[model samples]
Target: MFNNIFLLMRQELALSVLVFLLLFIKIGKERSNTSILNFVNIALFVNLIIGICFVGKGELFSGMFATNALIILEKNILNLAVLIISMQSFAWLKNHDQVIEFYLLIFTSLLGMFFLISSGNLLIFYLGLEMSTIPLAAAANFDLSKRKSSEAAMKLILSSAFSSGILLMGISFLYGTSGTLTFSILTAHISNNPLQLFAFILLVSGFAFKIAAVPFHLWTADVYEGAPIAVTSFLSVVSKAAVLFTFVSVLYKVFQPIASTWYLILILLAVVTILIGNLFAIRQDNFKRFLAFSSIAQVGFILIGISGSSVAGSASLIYFILIYVFSNLAAFGVVSLVSALTGKENISDYKGFYKTNPLLSWVLTIALFSLAGVPPTAGFFGKLFLMMAGAAKGNYGLITFAALNMVISFYYYLRVVKAIFMEENEAPIEKLGIPLVSKMAMYICVAGILITGLASMIYDYIYSLSFGL
Candidate 1:
């Protein structure tokens, strides 16, 4: 038990210590904020390396903490999120006054995510979720100058609290039905009870709010528009991915016998999320809000895989998320660069942006095309695998609708590309030089999008490792 607790505490301790060290270093030197940001990146990278070395398929703390191949994939994806987020945050923080606290909050949130993904019990999972969320709400309000930022924080807090209430109630119901909160034991106990079915619905609803699935996504646009772009990117990628990982684990491990219930629920949610996301994105003028809707639509694609309820489904979902992290980060990274340079976040502000920053324009073009699921990019292949997973389970209607949704999504994604490359501007925008770290992050994301698409071996390895009941 001591050994398990020690291992569980090690990674988090490293992160906390690094954050404090950076804080002290910042206080002593009065150097450029970039220096502290660099330290944060180094800390996160080191943590990633340590996680790779120490974390593997095993149980800890009497099975309350666990790790496996799937969790390793999750950790790597999150590490990539941290790297991208840190780079983007640095771009914004360079000129901002209150920068150190931003890094501290980000590290705290990521620490919570790490725990969330590795949690073996519902109690730990909820605690981790709240820890991750509360700091993020604070980060949303970090930009004290903007009223929208405060509004976003308040909305997020209110919505999060509501979701927590629903989740707690559901957990109580689940406990009453199964008499245990441990996933392994719950799996054995949750056979065919109607109350268990209701509990599953409530649990999924809570996750739906976290992932910004349709019918529960009212707060996404406001929060994205109000928060800093870096915080928005972190919320979109890392936070959403953590919730989905937990959702997949619970569906496959504890609720496998109730596939029929979740399948219908997931399919309906997918259809609504895809159509509504595309339709709403069509009218959005704010760049962050546009991507918010886009992220929701992407979640719909992920749900198609989950609806299938197979090891293939889990593998497909993970692959899609990995691809999405790259493509979405690339998009947001470019947006962060452009927004920082122009101090503009509106779509119209990007008019004739190509004239000044052709490289960024092209990067945004590629990112948008990938989001639209254009061929030869990672997003295309991610959707392809999801469709295949759905078909494997004989979900013909769901796959067909997903294909149609992809077509609808293309329209809005291409609109952003057109705005970047085709639209002319009356006012000439100044070209801003890309920072080395930011440029490297963008190039890595673009390369990852392409490489993951072309690499069949990686897909095969992931498919083989998925949990099979």
Candidate 2:
């Protein structure tokens, strides 16, 4: 039993140890934040490498937790994301007083995400969800001197509590009807009855809130704008990736019985989410808020893939997320560096930025190009596969609509690019000193975006996992 637990939960176990190591370091001596950050980054990189090299598969705790090739890949994707984030946060962390607390919160949320991904039952899923969310709420308040930071934390807490209630109510309804919480059993028991559908809607609402889908996305912009850049990056990349991964499992596996019903629901939500997210994003002068809405639009694209209800759909979703991690983080890396150096976060502040900061300008341009789904970038391939997977359902109209929305997305994404290169500013941001670690992180993200797009084999490997499943 012990061996099974260790084998099945190696990722979670290792992360817990890393968290403890950080705790011990915090208590032992008063080290410089730079040293602590260096230590943490090394540990995180080690963790990512270990996860990739030592993948495991099985179930434990009477099937309450499970792990497979796909889940392992999902977890490793997150590991890489956290490592990149830790690297990118170097400038911010080295100057902050609460470096250990920041990392502790990050790893705790990551540990919860590990459990959340492995959960085999509703109870375990909800437990993991709360564990992941609470830490992030605290992290949002890390900028203690800012009133907006406190407001961000408060809104997060209240919204989380509300979403948790809705989710739990859905779980109760599901259990009441199905008499089981285990995913495998729930799959067989899911029926398209009124109460069951209602429960499913409530559950999806909770998920929508997490992913920042339209109408449920009110808290996202405020939180992203108010939280420090590090937290915002974590929220945009790591947090969304975890929820979307689990959501794929729940909808495609556990609720497979009511596919048609949920497919319609997903379609409706995806269209609205894309339209609203894009429209609002265009109006945002605040860079963080702009990215917030952009992320919401990205979620809509993810839904189009999920709606396909096939192995292709699952593969596309994961592949796109991998591309998304690189693309989004690359953008955020530039944002973090610029914001940390200049205390600037507005779109107007970036006008003529390329004159002084050409490297960062190009990096952000590439990242935004990828986000806009432009060709030759990995994001283009990601969205291509997504739309192709969605097309498998023979809904050409919906596919065309999605494609058109992609054009809408392109306009706003390029707006920033244009500001950087084309617009003139008398007082542009100065040529700032870019940290070595942050530059390294940016290079990795740029490589990921380029390599993933060019390498078809990566997507093939992911598809093989989905097919095997």
Q: Which pairs clash inside model 1?
A: none
Cα deviation in Å at residue 131, candidate 2?
0.4
Q: Which digits, one per residue and each the tens of the lDDT, describe model 1 over residues 20-124?
A: 886787678687766766877777788778766665467876677787777877877887778877876567788888788887888888888878888889888
List TM-score per model, in order: 0.96, 0.99
Q: How does each model score on lDDT?
A: 0.85, 0.93
Best by TM-score: 2
lDDT of 2 at 314: 91
Q: lDDT tens digits, residues 1-469, model 2?
A: 7777777777888899999998998899799888888899999988887788866778887889989999999999999999999999999888999999999999999999999999999989999999999999999999999999999999998998999999999999999999999999888888889999999999999999999888899999999999999999999899999999999889888888888898899999999999999999999999999999999999999999989988999999999999999999999999999999999999999999999999999999999999999989999999999999889889999999999999999999999999999999999999999989999999999999999999999999999998312
Off by over 4 Å in 2: 467-469
